[model samples]
Target: MPSADRGVFSLIIINKAGGLIYQREFQAGLRKLSTNDYLVLAGTFHGVHAITRSITPRIPNSQPPPSPATSSPGTAPAVSGYSYPNPGVAVTGIDYLETDKFRLTCFQTLTGTKFLLFTDPMTGNVDTIVQKIYELYADFVMKNPFYQTEMPVRCEAFDRHLGAWLRGRT
Candidate 1:
């Protein structure tokens, strides 16, 4: 299981366009931002991520060039660009994870799914916690017949299970 040391600061989810889809801060004493500001940040980040992906260089083909005499005549080659397993999202970057008091975990799903989990920077096995949260999201949010994609995640069961699991671990 992922670590649960109460060092988490916040989590943010961004859409393909960098719109702030979700933002939540868990730790105490951190400065709070208005909902509008958080949304702006999400959008800005999304734009930057897309720009970064476009700027990334494409890998060149590995095949050696054929000699003129042996070369096949006039076959067009497919052009490709630098590609990462995109998850249909522009970019998923974790800016801050380790600090004196907190750590951040960011997970992006294949359909541009994004999950950001914060924890104690010193906590061990944070991945486990992340996996469990993801599972809960899948079971409660994605699996629910009522959940609409790109909408705010508001399942009561999700909140309950998340609180229970975190409390238990802590």
Candidate 2:
């Protein structure tokens, strides 16, 4: 079992089609889940993320319109913008979900790949960690010629680099 101070518990990567691409447990803080259970969890989270994105309340455009030079022809922006917290940015589903035991931090790439990081509730700098994980994925997994798109990640380098990076964090 992992010590109480271990910050990260696990990481789950989901493809654009809601398939589980990669999953790793950094610390044995949580009970072990079966392979099927992990797949189901990935699918369920993907559905919930879609629902959350769809249901997010769009605030009306209260700010002034872009100037003539910036404004495109016949392309006025939506009256009700989808982005929350930022107007121009597109809506990515729930960024962080916190519970008494742990916090789930999600980071979605522009290509729709999602990184789900499970960390201790008290863990800080989760965003930075997620970003670094994404960078590692891009470098080790995506860059590998043998890697197929939207498939399970089997790259040894990705696994090695990710484990090393997480270990350095604690």
Candidate 3:
């Protein structure tokens, strides 16, 4: 991938409750916000997610989506469709990057773990990169016994691997 295709602007990890658990910016030129403000945003999003799940309609004994048909029955339920109860955070929506210099991509795991990835707006294959990051988090952070849920994700291995991977890709 080209350097421009792999550059990341920042990342944020939010808890199920929408509390900002972790955040870091790699590139420059984005407007800065106070640490307190970032925390508030996370908490607000968490509330929105809870509201969404509660409002999401329950599907009773319904057939899975077409994409799930290719997978085994054991995994078919995992591929079930989702309906957004609210407009924004409830559905993993992407908030616009400030100044148009970057793009913000949000990924919400089925367990309500959220990863916010910031990248160059024009970058390609960002979803792959984000998936790798999520994999790293599951391996290095979530698996660590020392990591407490809803706390800041401060695993040194995660940072090292993420930086090294991004550097290698760029």
Per-residue alpha-carbon lDDT of candidate 2 for residues 1-170, written as tens digits (9 for 90 to 100): 35547588999999999999999998864799999999999999999999999887765556755666786788876343223667677877788999998899999998899999999888879999999999999999999999999999999999999999888877
Pull out the clashing pairs in model 3.
17-46, 18-42, 18-43, 18-46
* Model 2 TM-score (2 dp): 0.84
> How do the residues 53-163 of candidate 1 rate in per-residue lDDT, one tens digit apiece?
566554444565555666567865533433446436454455334667567666666776666676767776777777787888888878989988888777788778777
Ranking by TM-score: 2, 1, 3
The digit string of per-residue lDDT tens for model 3 on 1-113 reads 46654488788899876778888877666789899988887777667656654555644434646665566776535644553444354444443334466677767888777
lDDT of 3 at 97: 38
Clashes of each: 10, 0, 4
Residue runs of model 3 more than 4 Å from their true location after superposition: 1-6, 47-99
Segments in model 2 whose C-alpha atoms lie over 4 Å from true places:
1-4, 61-85
Poorest 10 consecutive residues by lDDT, candidate 3: 89-98
